[model samples]
Every structure is written in C-alpha cells, then in structure tokens.
Target: MTSEGTFCLVLHSHLPWLPHHGSWPVGEEWLYQAWAHSYLPVVELLRRFAGEGRRDVLTLGVTPVLAAQLDDPYSLRTFHEWLGHWQLRALHASTLWRGQPVLRELGAAEHRAALHATEDLETQWRHGFSPILRSLVDAATIELIGGPLTHPFQPLLDERIRAFALRSGLDDTGLRIGHRPAGIWAPECGYAPGMEDGYAAAGVERFLVDGPSLRGDTSAARTVGSSDVVCFGRDLEVTYRVWSPKAGYPGHANYRDFHTWAHEVGMKPSRVTGHQVAPPDKAPYEPALAADTLRLHVKDFVDTVVTRLRRLRARNGKEALVVAAYDTELFGHWWHEGPAWLDGILRALPEAGVRVTTLRGALEAGHLGPPVDLPASSWGSGKDWRVWDGEQVADMVEDNAALQRRLLAVRPGPLRDPVLDLAVNEAMLALSSDWAFMVTKDSAADYARRRARVHTERFGAVLRGERPLPLEDRVFGQLDARLL
Candidate 1:
C-alpha cells in the first residue's frame, strides 16, 4: 500500500550546564535523572533500531551545553556515582518498605530498573554520549540536530550574540559527534524574522518552530523569508496526543505517576490512579499494567497520525509532512512508559502505511511549502515571546538586555582572551531560556532566578578582573569572544 505523508519526530534534548553548581532538587540531580531515565534508554533503543538496519528514524537535538556535560570527565564520573547511589536507594527502598506488599513490589521493580540502568551506563555510556551518538549518526539511524550554547531564547538575544552562539554551538557538536548538523531545534523553537540569515550563515539548512508560528498550517516545512533555510513547524494536533499541560497519554491511570513520591527512597511508587486522587491514595505503579496501557496509546497514536495524514492529503492534494517534536526528557524521565510507546509507534507507523523520517529526509523528499514571513515567536505560552518577555519577567528581560550590552562593549578580538572569553561564556549562561521558562512556570523558580543572577554577576566579576576564571565554568572551552 502507498504511504501517506511523511512523519518526522524531532526530540530536543537539553539541560543548562549544571556542574560546580548545586546538586539536589534542581541542579545535577535534574541532569542525572534525565540521563538515567531518558537519555540512557532512548539512545539504547535507537541503537537497537540501528542494529535492525533502521535509518533516519528521527531527529535528535543535543544542545551544546548539555553535550559538553555528557562528554565531560567530571560529569561522567559523577553520573556513574549517581547511578550507584540510585541502586543503593532502590535497595534501601526494597528493605524499608518490605513490610508493605504494595510498596515492596514497587521497590523491587525500581531496584531491577536501577540495576539495568547501572549496567547500561557502565558498558555503553562509560566513555560519554559522544561515541554512542556518533556511532548511531554514522550508521545513518538518526539525524542529529544541534542548538545554541546554553539554549538561550534567540528571539530575545542580541543579533551578534545569537549568531556567535549558534555558530559556536554547531562547531561544538561537530567536535563531539564528528558531524555538524544542518538542522537545529532553535532554542525553544524561538524565531525572529531575520534569524534565518544567521542560520544560513552558520550553515543551518533547517530548523523548527511552533505550529502557531506558521499559523497552524504545519502540513509542510516552509522556507522562511526567502532564505533556503526551512522552518519545520510542530503539528500540535499530533504532538499533543503524547504531551500537553492539561492532559496526555502519560496521565493514563495505568502509567506511573510522575509527582507521587516515595520520599524516603527517592522513587515514584504510584500510578496515576486518578487526577484528583491524593498521592497516598494513588495506586501502586504496576509495570505490566503500564505496558498494557502503552500498547493501546501507541495504537491510538498511529491511528491519529494515519487519520491526520489522510485529512491533510485530501486538503492539500499532496502527501504533506506531519512533524511532531518534543523534549527528549519527556520519554522515560517525565513519562515512564514513553520510551516503550516510542518504540511501538516507530514500528507501528510503517506497518500502518505511514512513512516515518527525519525533518531533513522530509525536505529532501520535497516536503517544502511556500515561503513565510515568520513573525517573532516561540513555543512558549501564547506562541509568542510573552513567557520570556512578559510583565512577570520584565526584570529578567531588562537584565538580559543589560548583560548583552556589556558583552558587546567588551568587543574582544579574534585572539582568545581568557578573561573576555570566560566573561562571554558567563553572559551566555545567564541568557539561557530555561531560567525564565522555569520562573514563569514556577518550577524551581528560585533556583532559576539564582542561576541567572549568579552567572550575570560572574560575567561582571570576570570583566572587572575581580574574579579569576574558574575551571568549573569551562563548558565552551573553544568559545572565542571574537565570535560575538
């Protein structure tokens, strides 16, 4: 049977640099959790697909900042230690909760998972993510995407700073993965009218934006502002099936609940029994039940894509493109059954007469639409810059503007100036979009504010020579101030 339009799944993986910072609740803990649950499993799954001779399964974006940490010696050692601790905690849970049958079962399940993850990390991820990612890229199993350093909100960034960050970020990816990707996730799918000029200059041929950014006509990738740079807008209708603030597949009663905590052992032991169910009243998480629910959701998602493509083809008179993008962390980290669901969907799509490919593959197959004069937008609230620039974050916006101005004033030359380069790095770190997004969402708002302010203060201290450059903040080691 002939296939419908192509389905491109783009997973944006990112975390602000966290080493030498706090650990618990919001720092390295955040990175390790995503690493253990999402990165480890997702990459392993891709390797399995590659072993099966799959090519161009999906597009994976790894921000330069996170890439650095994944490959950093400090991060590697710490992550291994973290995994060991995870195993110990799971064992402790199993011992402490043995009196309660339900909690004991959950504890035993967690221990098994933690043990498997530890072995996976010690074997496949021993060196770092670079080797594993490079092998997959070389095998043509996935198209890797790179994004700006620190994952700054580009639409709000100074043009010079934005251009420098994008180029440096691409270069960083090339250094780590041995391939500089032509596609980017565009830091929150944030875009401004002329950002494509910078993208084109940096050799970025394609990028992503929110569905509403392209006015919800995401049936095809559109070239922005006459540049050859293509903007692939997310098909919200398709993506929201798996993830959305209000509700999604993860909320299924059979799936493990992300919020319910087993405080003593630091594990989630409950299923999402009911939305309004108290945490203590939530049912114990049953892996087999979640697996059954995952199968159903996967089938539903495949059907959704089939129906969407048929509708789009009828309307557009062609096999249009349907792009569904999400944060890679959403998989095993936030949604415990996500990786399994992903595996099922990827395998099921082709069987259902749907062509699954990367964004680059879709474009090469002639999925391009007419050029669009894209307005300033982001994938944030309102599909505008409000989340980063609203009255609620006016102070942050102003502070970022001031930092950029100070950075530009330094105007360091092509020759590397240790002080100046470190200053630029600090400035970029402060400009990360995660901080404002967290503040607006009230998720670790205090930590986010502190991180931003600390980086900003360090930027000033470096410029004044009041603070010596620390080895800990050496994320962008090759960052040249001249790039700005």
Candidate 2:
C-alpha cells in the first residue's frame, strides 16, 4: 500500500554543561538522571533498530555543550560512579523501605535497571557517548543535528558571537561524530528573519522552527527568505498528542507520576492515579499496567497521525510532511514508558502505511514547499521569545547583551590565549538559554540565576587575570577566540 506522508521525529538532546558544577537539586545530578533514564535507553533502542537494519529512523540534535560533557573524561568517570551510586541507592530503597511492598518492588526494579545501565556504561559508553552516537550515524540509523555552543538563544545573540558559536559548534560535532551535520535544532527553535543567512553561511542545509513561525501551515519544509536553507516547522497538532504540559499520553492515569516520589528511597513509586490526586494518595505504580497504557497510547498516536496525514493530503492535494520534534529527555526521563512507547510507534508506523523518516530524508523525498520569511519566533510561550527574553528575564537579557559586548571587545587577534578562550567559554555558558527559561518558568529559578551570575563573574575574572584558568573548565578546546 502507498504511504500517506512522511513522519519526521526530531529529538533535541541537550543539557547545559554540568561537570565541575553542583549536583543534587540541579546540576550533574540532572545530567546523571537524564543520562540513566533517557540517553542510555533511547540510544539502546536506536541501536536495536539499527541492528534490525532500520535507517534514518529519526533526526537527533545534540548540542555542542552536552556533547562535550558526554565525551569529557571527567563526565565519563563521574557518570560511571553515579551509576554505581544509583545501584546502591536502589538497594538502599529495597532494604530501607522493606515495610512497604510497593516500595520494595519498585526498588528491586530500579536496582536491576541501574545494574544494566552500569554495565552498558562500562562497555558501550566506556569511552563516552561520542563513539556510540557515531556508530549510530555511521550505520545510517539516525541523522545527527548539531547546534551552537552552550545552547544560546540565537535570535537574541550578537551576530558575531552567534556565527562564531555556530561554526565552532559544527566543527566540534564534526570532530566528535566524524562529520558535521547539515541540519540543526536551532536553540529553543528561536529564530529571527535573517538568521537563515547565518545558517547558510555555516553550511546548515536545514533547521527547525515553531509551527506558528510558518503561520501554522506546516504541511512541508519551506525555504527561508532567499537562503537555500530549509526550515521544518513542528506540527503541534501531532507533536502535542504525545507531550504537552497540560495534557498528553504521559499524564495518563496508569502511567508513573513524575512528581510523586518516595523521598526515603529517592524513587518514584506511584502512578498518576488522578490529576488532582495528592502525591500521598496516588496509587502505587505498576509496570504491567503502565505497559498496557503505553500500548494503547502508541496505537492512538499512530491513528492520530494517519488521520492527520489523510486530511492534510486531501486538503493540500499532496503527501504532506508531519514533523514531531521533542526534547530527547522526554523519553524515559520525564515519561518513564517513553522509550518503550517510542519503540512501539516506530514499529507500528510503517505497518500502518506511514512513512517514518528524518527531516533530511523527508527533504530528499521532496517534502519542500514554498519559501517563507519567518517572523521572530520560538517554540516557547506564545510561540514567541518571551520565555528567554520576557519581563521576568529582562535583567538576564540585558546582562547577556553586555557579556557579548565584553567578549567581542576582548576578541583575540592571532595569538591563542588559554585565558581568553576560558573567558569566551564562560561568556557562552552565561548566555545559555536554559537559565532564562528556568527563571521564567520558576523551575529552579534560583539555581538558574546563580549559574548565570557565576559564569558572568568567571568571565570577568578570567578577563582581568584575577583568577587562574582551571584545567577542568577546558571545554571547546578547539575554540579559536579570534572567531569572535
């Protein structure tokens, strides 16, 4: 049977650099948790698909900052240790909470998962994530996407810094992955009108934008402005079916509740029994029930895509493109059953007469549409740049602008100064979009502010030669300060 239209699942995998940083509430702990729950499992699933000869299964964006950490020696050692600790914690949960049968079972499950993850890390991920990711790319199982250093909000970034960051980022990815990607998941999908020129200059063949940025007609990829660079807008109607803040399959009653945790065990043992159900009142999580719910949601999502594609074809008189982009951390991390659900969807889509492919694959399959001049937009609140540049974050926006100026002023001539490079690194870290987004959403706003301020202070101290450049802060070792 003929397929309806192409389905492109773009997963943006990113986390601000966190290796010498703090832990627990929000830091390396964030990285370790996501690494265990999401990255490890997601990559494993992709490897499984590749073993089955699946090619171009999805488009994956790995920010340069996160990639650096994944491949960093410190991160590799620490992550391994963290996995061991995870196993210990799970064992503690089982023994410490023996009185609670549900807790004991959950603890045992977690222990097994931790043990497997530790073994996987010791073997496949021993070197770092680069080798594993490169293997996937080499096998043509996934199309890798690259992004700027530190995941800065490009639309608000100074032109010189933005271009430098983009180029350096692409080069960094090439260094790690054996080739630079032609596509990128623009930081936060934040884009301004003329940014496509920068993308074109950097050799980026395609990028992603919010659905509203293209005026909601995301039937296919569109060339932006006069640049040959194509932009694929997320089909919110399709993407939101699986994940939206207010409602989504992840919030199903039978699924594990992300918020309800056993504080003593440091594990979540409750199901999302009800939306308003207090954490203490929520029912114990049952993996079997969650698996059943996952199967149902996977079927529903496939049906939704089929119906949407049929309607789009009828309206446009052609097989349209449906791009569902999401944070890679959503799988297994935010949604416990997400990895399994992903496996089911990938297997089911092809059987249901749906063509699953990467954005590059879709483009190659002739998914291009008319050119568009997109407005300043993002995949944030109101589909605008407010989340990163809102009133609540006005101070941060101003500080970022000042930091960019300082960085440009101190731009190295031809000589490579380690201090200057470190300064530039600090500046980029300060400009990360995560801090602003966290502040705006109040999701660890204090930590966000502290991190931003610390980076800014470090940038100043390095410039003034007030502090010695630490060997540990050596990320982007290939970064040439003259680029700024």
Best by lDDT: 2
Predictions: Cα RMSD each: 1.2, 1.1
TM-score of every candidate relative to the true structure:
0.98, 0.98
- How do the residues 1-484 of candidate 2 rate in per-residue lDDT, one tens digit apiece? 9988889999999999888889888999999989999999999999999999999999999999999988999888989998888888899999987998876888999999999999999899999989999999999999999999889999898899899989999999999989899999999999988999999999999999989998889989999999899999999999999987678999999999998878776889899999989998999898989988888998999999999999999999999889999999999999999999999999999999999999989988999998999999999989999999899999999999998888888848688888888899889889999999999999999999999999999999999999997878778898878777
lDDT of each: 0.91, 0.92
Compared to the true structure, candidate 2 yields what TM-score?
Answer: 0.98
Clash count of each predicted structure:
0, 0
Worst 10-residue lDDT window for candidate 1 reads 407-416
